[model samples]
Target: MTIERAVPAFAGFMILLSVALTHWVSPYFVWLTVFVGANLFQFAFTKFCPAALVFKVTELKSAGQS
Candidate 1:
């Protein structure tokens, strides 16, 4: 998949993983959930997600780029 699609797909997977960890692993995992949510919120405005950077380094073209 392109970077555009991969970024959000990875984020959704991480959010779900954090939620599951919070429920089954430890309550402190809730902090991960909060972090991911906040990161997503800020990314909407900043458009500078670290994951996107990684995707770029890996040479994944965005849909628009293609």
Candidate 2:
């Protein structure tokens, strides 16, 4: 998958994994999930995701047009 797609996919997977951890492992993990979710939400709203930036950099380095 392209870096553009991978960033959000990884973020989503991490959020889901965090949720699962919170449910099956420890409640503290819920905070971690919340932290990730908040960042994603902020990115969605502000259009300034760090993940997206990283993806863009990787894409540029790889000579991939994003």
Candidate 3:
């Protein structure tokens, strides 16, 4: 998927994973959901996402070469 799609997809996946972890693993996993939400919140104003950056650096290198 494109960066536009992948970022949100990744964020959603993290949120779900965090919730599952919180349920079966530990409450500390809720912090992960909080972190992802906060990053999305800041990205709204800053337009800078670390996940997107990582995706760019790693994903582009591998996928774009195809």
Give the per-residue lDDT of model 2 (tens digit) for 1-66.
Answer: 676577678888989999899899999998988888898889778877777677777653323753
Tell me the whole-model lDDT of each prediction, alpha carbons only.
0.89, 0.78, 0.89
Per-residue lDDT of model 1, residues 1-66, tens digit only:
898899889989998998999899999998988888888899999988989899899999988885
TM-score of each: 0.89, 0.69, 0.86
True-structure Cα RMSD, model 2: 3.1
Off by over 4 Å in 2: 56-66
- Per-model C-alpha RMSD: 1.0, 3.1, 3.4
Tell me the spans in candidate 1 whose CA falls farther than 4 Å from its real position: none
Roughly what TM-score does model 2 have, to 2 decimal places?
Answer: 0.69
Query: Evaluated with TM-score, which candidate comes out highest?
Result: 1
lDDT tens readout by residue for model 3, 1-66: 677778999999999999999999999999999999999999999999999898897664433554
Task: Output candidate 3 Cα RMSD.
Answer: 3.4
Ranking by TM-score: 1, 3, 2
Backbone collision tally, model 3: 0
